[model samples]
Target: MKQWLQAFIAAIQFLTRIPVPVNVPFTNEVLKRSTLFYPWAGCIVGVLIWGAGLGLQLVLPAGPAAVLTLALAVALTGGLHMDGLMDTADGVLSHRSRERMLEIMKDSRVGAMGVIACILVLLLKWSLIASLMTAGAWQLWLVVPFIWSRAAMVWGMTNEPYARAESGLGSYFQGLHRGHLLGAVFSALMLSLATVYIMVSVPLEMAGWSASFAALAAYAIHPWWLLLGAPVLGMGAVWGCSRYLSKKLGGLTGDTYGAMNELTETILLLLLVLMTGWRG
Candidate 1:
C-alpha cells in the first residue's frame, strides 16, 4: 500500500504542479512505474476542473467560466502540454526535413505555426467548454476528456518509440512495458467508476433515494457512459496520431506526447458537445 501510494504521488508530481508534499525516490524505475498512475493523476485534474466549472457557472457567465477553467487546466500542468503543442506545430507544420523538423521542435523559440496552433486549440477548447456550460451539460462526464487525454499520452508513450536518440524527458518513459499500458487503462476505468459513485451517492444522500435513482436514470442520455469506451477510443486515436507523427518525425517525442494530449482532449470535448448539446 505504501509503495502504491508513493507511485501515485510520483505520478502527480510528474504530471502536475500540484504540491503533493511527500518525499519519494525519483529514479528511472520509479518514473517508469509512475506511468500506471498517469490517468489517476489526470482523474484528479478532471475532478478539480469539473468542480471549478460548476462553481464558476453559479456566479459568472459561461464565457468567463470557460476562460478561467481553461486557464486552470494549463496552470495545473504548468503549460507543459501547451508548450509541446507549440513545439510540435513549429516542427511538423514547417514541412522541413525530418531531421530538421526534430531540431525545430527541440528549439525553445516558438514560431508562427506554433503560435497559431496554440491559439486555435485554446479557442476550440474554450468554445466547446463554454457551449457545454451554456447548454447545461455539467454532468460528471465532462471529466472523462481530462482523464482520457492523459491516458492517451501514456498509451502513446508506451506503444511508440522515442524520437530522440539520446536525451529528452520522453526517454525516461521508454522502459515502459505492457504492464504500464494495462495499468493505465485500468486506473482510468476505476477513476470513472469512482466518479459515478460520487455523483450518484452524494445525490442519494442529500436528496433521498428517489432523486438519486432519477439521476441514475438520466445516465441513459449522459455522456458519462462514454467513459466506458474511452480506453479503446482514446488509445486507437492516440495510436493513429503516433503513427502519423512518427512518419513525419521518425518517432514520438516528448513534444508529440503533449501534442497528442491536447488534440485528444479537444476531440473528446467536441464529441461531448455533440453527444449532449447537439440534440435535435
Candidate 2:
C-alpha cells in the first residue's frame, strides 16, 4: 500500500508541475512501475481543469472562458505535451530520412511545421471547448478525455518499442509489462464510471429506483453513450498513431508520446462536440 502511494506520488511529480512530498527513489525501474498511475495523474489534471473551466464560465462568456481554460490547462502541464506535439510535427513532417527526422525532433529549435501544427491544434481545441461550454455539456464529462488520453499514452508505451537508441525520458518506459497496461485501463474505467454515476445515476435515483434504472437504460441508448466509447477510441488512436510514427521515424519517441496524448484529447473533444450538436 505504501509503495503504491509512493508510486502514485511519483507519477504525479513526474507528469505534472504539481508538488508532491513523497521522495520515492528516482530510478528507471521505479519510473517504469509508476506508469501504472498515469491515468490517476491525468484525473488530477482533469479535475483541476474542470474546476477552472467552471469558475471561468461564471465571470466570462463561453468563448473567452474556453480560451482561458485551455490556457490554464497548458499552464498546468507547463506545455509538456504541447512541446512533444510540436517536436513531433517538426520531425515527422520534415520529409527527411528517419534518422534526419529523429535528429530534427531532438534539436532544441522549433521549425515551421511544428509552429503551424501547434497553432492549428490549439485553435481546434479552443473552438471545441467553447462549443461544449456553450452547449452546457461541459460537465464531469470534461474529465473523461483527460483520463483516457493518458491511458492511451500508457497503451502506446506498453505495446510499442521506444524509438531512440540513446538514453532519454522515453527509454524509461520501454517494454512496459502487460500488468501495467491493465492497471492503467482499469484506472481509466473506474474513473469514467464514477464520473457517470455521480453526474447521471445519482440524480435519477431521487425520482425512485425504477426511474433511475430507466434513465440508465435511456442513457445507454442516448447519443451521449458515445462518450463511453472514448477509451476504445483513444486506444485505437494511439495504436494507429504509434504505427504511423514508427513507419515514419522507426519507432515512438518521448515527443511522439506527448503527441499521442494531445491528439487523442482533441479527437475526443471533437467527437463530443459533434454528438452534442453545439448546444448554444
Candidate 3:
C-alpha cells in the first residue's frame, strides 16, 4: 500500500507541475509501477480542465474561456508533452536519414517545422473547445481529452521498445510486461466511467431546483457504452502511431510517446465534436 501510494505520487510529480512535497524514490521498479497511475494522474488533469472550464464560462465568453482553459492545461504540464511534440515534429519531418532525424530531435532547439506543428495542434484544440463551449453541459468532454491522451502514453511505453541507444527518461519504463499495460488500461476505463457520472452529477443535484436542469440531467445521462469507446480508441491510437514511429525510428522514444499523447487527445476531441454535431 505504501509503495503504491508512492508510485501514484511519483506519477503526479513527473507528469504535472503539481507539487507533491513528499519524498518519492524513483527506483526502476517504482518508475515501472508508476506507469499504472499515469491514467490517475490524467484524471487529476482532467478534473482541473473540467473545473477551470466551468469557472471560466461563468464570467467570460466562450472564446476567452476556451483560451484560458487551454492555457491552463499547458501550464499545468509545464509544456513537457508539448516540447516533446515539437521535438518529434522536428525529427520525423526532416526527411533526412532516420539516424539524423533522431539526432535532430535530441537537440534543444525547435525547428521551423516544430513550430508549425505546435501552432496547428493548439489551433485545433482551441477551435474544437470553443465550439463545444456552445453548451456548457459539454464541458465534460474537455476533461476526457487529457485523460485518454495520457493513457495513450502508457500504451505506447508498454507496447514499443525504446528507440534511444542511450538511456533516457523513457528507458526506465522499457520492458514493461502486459500486467502494467492492463493496469493502465484499467485505470483509463474506470476514469472514463466516472466522467459519465460527472457530466450529469451537477445536473442531477440541480434538477429539483429547476425544471430546465431536470431536463438537462435527463439529456446528460448517456448510455455507459458511449464512453467505453474512449479507452479503446486511446489504446488503438498508440498502437497505430507508435508502430509507425517505431518503424521509422527503429523504436519509440520519449518524444514519440508525447506525440502519441497529443495525437490521441486531438483525435478524441475531434470525435467528440463530431458526435455532438451528429446528435444535434
Candidate 4:
C-alpha cells in the first residue's frame, strides 16, 4: 500500500503542475509501480482543464475561449502525447517492416503521415472543444475521458511487452503486476466519482439554494449517465492499440501508449459532444 501511494504521488508529480505534497523516491521499484498511478495523473490533468476552462469562461470571449482551452491541453503536457500520436502514426503508415516502422518512429524528422495526423488531431480537438463549450457540457464530458485515457495508457503498458530493447518509457512499465493494474482502475473510478459529485451534484445543490447561481448556470448541460462510457472506451482503446502494435511490431512502445491515450481522448471527447446533441 505504501508503495502504491508512492507510485500515485510520483505520477502526480511527474504528470501535472498540481502540487500533491509528494516527494517521489526514484528507485527502479518505484518507477515500475508508477504505472498504477497513471490514471490519477490523468485526473490531475482533467482538474486543471476544468478549472482553467471555468476561469477562462469568466474572462474570455467564446472565440478566444475555445483556443485557450485547446492550447492549455497541449501546453499542460508539453505536447508529449500529441508528439507520440504523430510519430506512431508515421511509423504505422510508413509501409515498412516492423523494424523499419520502429526506426521511422525514432526518426526526428516529421514525415508526411506524421504531419497529416497531427493536423487532423489538432483540428478535431479544436472542433470538439468548441462544441463542448457551446453545449456547456465541457466539464461532464471532459472529466472521465481525460481520466480514462491515461488509464488506457496504464493498461497498454502493463499488458504489452516492450517492442524495442531501448525504445522509450514502455520498456519501464511492461512488467507491471496485476496489483498495479487494479490500482490504476480503482484510482480512475474514484476520480470519476469525485468529478461527478463536484461537476454535477454540487452545482445542482448550489443552484437550488441560490437563484442568482441558477440563472447564471446553464441547465446541467451534460448528461450524468454519460459518465459510464469513459471506462468502456478506455479499455477498448488499450485492447485495440496493444493488439495492433503487437501485430505490427511484435510488442508495444512508450510512443504507442502515449499515442493511444491521445487518440482515445480525442475520440471520447468527440463522442461525448455528439451525445450531448449540442451543435456548435
At residue 75, candidate 3 shows an lDDT of 90
CA lDDT for candidate 4: 0.76
Count of backbone clashes, every candidate in sequence: 0, 0, 0, 0
Question: What is the alpha-carbon lDDT of model 2 when measured against the actual structure?
Answer: 0.84
Per residue, candidate 1 scores C-alpha lDDT tens digits across 83-114 of: 99999999999999999999999999999999
TM-score of 3: 0.90
- After superposition, the stretches of candidate 4 with alpha carbons farther than 4 Å from their true spots are 1-5, 17-25, 209-234, 278-280
Ranking by lDDT: 1, 2, 3, 4
For each candidate in the order shown, give its overall lDDT on alpha carbons.
0.86, 0.84, 0.82, 0.76
State TM-scores per candidate. 0.91, 0.90, 0.90, 0.86
Least well predicted 10-residue stretch by lDDT in candidate 2: 215-224
lDDT of 3 at 124: 96
User: Per-residue lDDT of 23-96 in model 3, one digit per residue for the tens?
Assistant: 99988889889989998888898788878888898899999999998999899889888899999999999988
| Model 2 bad stretches (over 4 Å) | 205-232, 278-280
